[model samples]
Target: MAAREILADFPAGGPRGSWPAEEKAAELTRQGQPATVRMDLASDRFLVVPVGERS
Candidate 1:
């Protein structure tokens, strides 16, 4: 399978924490697509990506 692409990046804070990423991932999953949250190289950012099928 092809590697997933980053859909968005969310910064850690009082409002834009990992919640948005999580919500987006969940929405994708509900639509039969797999999604994931990953930390950037510096470990200071959250990235949401589509992982194709659930498998």
Candidate 2:
């Protein structure tokens, strides 16, 4: 499978849940870079990547 370009990452342990990652994705989308959030279980972090990207 093709590797996705990660736009940003946030710790999964954040007290605010996934809000930060989700907000980042939304912001990127509004900026024309359409993005989404996915859980990186191995790294225990939230990854912000382009829409349709898969691990």
Judging by TM-score against the true structure, name the best candidate: 2
Stretches of candidate 1 above 4 Å error? 1-4, 14-18, 52-55
Worst 10 residues of 2 by lDDT: 10-19
lDDT of 2 by residue, 6-53 (tens): 999999998844489999999999999999999999999999999988
RMSD of 2: 1.7
What's the lDDT for all of these models?
A: 0.71, 0.92
Candidate 1 per-residue lDDT, tens place, 1-55, comes to: 6554787777755383339878878887898878887766565777877774231
**Per-model TM against the reference:** 0.62, 0.86
Q: Return the TM-score for candidate 2, rounded to 2 decimals.
A: 0.86
Once superposed on the true structure, which residue ranges of model 2 sit more than 4 Å away at CA? none
